[model samples]
Target: MDGQPTADVVDQVKDIPIYRTSVERGHFPILEKPEIADGFPDNWMTPRLAAALAAGEAEFVLSTGTNHARMQIIRPPYFLLNSYYKLWSEHPDISATWEAGCQRVSLTTVLATEHVARVNAKKRGGEPEAVPPLDDRRLDARTLYLNLRLDPALWERDDVVRMLAEIRTAQQAHPRGWYHLDCSGYHLAHLVQKARAWGLWEDFPQPASIIHAYEYTPLNVRRHLREHFTCPVVDLFGSTELGYLYYSDRHGHYRPYLDEMSVELVPVAPGSRIHSLIVSSVRNPYMPLIRYRSGDCARTLDGSPDPEKISRFCGREKELLATPHGPVAQADLDDRIADASPRVFLHQLHVTAGEAVLHHTTFDGEPLDPRACAVLERELRGLTGLRSRIEHREHIPVGKSGKYAWLVQDR
Candidate 1:
């Protein structure tokens, strides 16, 4: 089946309003953004779902959509928050690392000024975080989220000082002085680097557990944290559309947490090890996605396109680079850089017709050698069939949400 859902699966979501056409057609094609977003509530609404929303049984969540258009989706109230807590509180290996009732703090991408204020309001009984608070069946605790949004240049700004102070306060205010750091890995790395620069490393709290769910954590960031901190650094792999489906273990190996979803991987090109992730999820009761091209890519352990052997959720599919030879993914470029030097902390590939420029920085804050640069350029040219140039930088810029893009095209 190669991960594609059989026609019988259509019966699963047979009643969903949006799937009526596909159900009639008898062949469910891959769902795309336009169909998912346009006409939204009406396109997806069913009488039962409408009653759920109107009666406060369901709610809406917004997606950050770092690389594409933002989206709004209907979901069970507190769906993501509850799902996250369930994953943590249920895992024996991960749960023991923290106190039974330790508070959870989210300093990741979802934390922003307005969102923090709203959450605080809910805690104060001034507003409600979720309807009926899920009858208090959901986890109840004050979540200390960041009020400031992350940006590429946040570390260099004066406002970040207050953010650092806020984080310190959150840590110290805890009775045990150890709480979970629910953060984006990139954002956490930025915080640590900035803390070191400001001489605040001594005051920085050591988290009992770390959860990085917002985005992909590069190998360099993971290695740095594992080397310095003696805590479990967990990486949750999933999307806003689908709650986390996989998580990394202590050894950095991903294990499936698939609840109501099936996944398949199709090769990026003929004989290529890399494959695009296609997901069929009926996890969300309000909306279901079938044969959805997640725009995420991965590779198998033994160079075969097998779902069970999937190794890493490597990179995005839309960002693939077209060269004279063939298409190359962000992971391919990242692998080349990693093979070239251990000191390379971050990199971005900017490409134009027949040429490419690499903006990269080293961990030691030193410039990459011209000889080493030439060697990598030669390698990239050989692999991509384009002239490549390396530009050593003190830091490569990140997106507004503090996520780095490995590839940026000029043309």
Candidate 2:
């Protein structure tokens, strides 16, 4: 659209750019000697990108990388605005729920743990046992893990019972559903289980389809909802790079936002065609990324990048747990335990850390017989490589950033 031809713009960035910008965005990571731009970091910003920036189009920046290796990605303002619109303003179901005056009762840990730390029990099962004593737990909202690990009996504790009563009072004051409960599938399951334990299963007002993102919405969670509530349980799929790319239909099956995203598949090994995702989105014009790796495995009916036909968007490749044979994806663990109970959604399995803890939460907060929890613990040990003493924790806070961390490493 500017002075340069499209071909010239495309050719200038024919190769990958070396990234040096701040991991958080805009803070440049490296200042090159300029004598040799060739040796710059990989995934660098190109001249074409600079031109687009000069033209006053790109606005929002998205980050891509592991916890340590983050990269800044800019996009046209319209892309994000539209994305938000489609999610809330345009979606009648969501908008209607919001307009009802629901306040965000986030189960997410925005800050680190705080004053109530000592109360946190030691993790007993899985490899690498860890006990984050109250002093170790962060106080800020960001660090508190959401109560994703639900033990049905947790509600029996006076504090939890009080919280439920408080929530119910707030709901009554608002009348039309006053609170919005946001969490992952696992988190919601814990909530449901907690509610059941209080003899409040039919009593507690259900949230507008508990927004379960940050992980695959295990099928059992959906079944749990359909069986328990009259409300729709939404499952959304996206990454930090792509934002929210796919969401469940009213029926709760994912429908791709193909109009906004372009998807590609890159082989995992050299020859084996089983590939993960590489996204090149026109969503953000400020920083138009070409063939951006999403680190997620996927499969489409036909050999195509068409987002609509993508049959599956499995767990992150990097997050896959190592097993004796090879690697085991999160879905594999989910499948093995799927039959354990639809009531169970939130789960964390740490191997050999403390004892070996398989902290789990179901929709109805009924405590599993210690024996059942033990069975799950043993199964998880065999699945992952770790011997552990099994026990249940009432609390497993989600990261305040609004994503759930499945695997926690202690030490």
Best by the TM-score measure: 1
Q: Write the per-residue lDDT of candidate 1 for residues 287-345, one digit (tens) a residue.
A: 77888887888877897767778778877778788776677877677667777776677
lDDT tens digits by residue: candidate 2, 160-203 = 55445545654565566555555555445555666676566666
Q: What 10-residue stretch in candidate 1 is worst by lDDT?
A: 130-139
TM-scores of the models, in the order given: 0.87, 0.58
Candidate 2 local Cα displacement, residue 287, angstroms: 1.1
lDDT against true structure, model 1: 0.73
Question: In candidate 1, which residue pairs clash?
Answer: none
Candidate models: Cα lDDT each: 0.73, 0.51
What are the root-mean-square deviations of the candidates from the true structure over C-alphas?
4.5, 10.9
Per candidate, the number of residue pairs that clash is: 0, 74
Provide the lDDT at 62 for model 2: 32
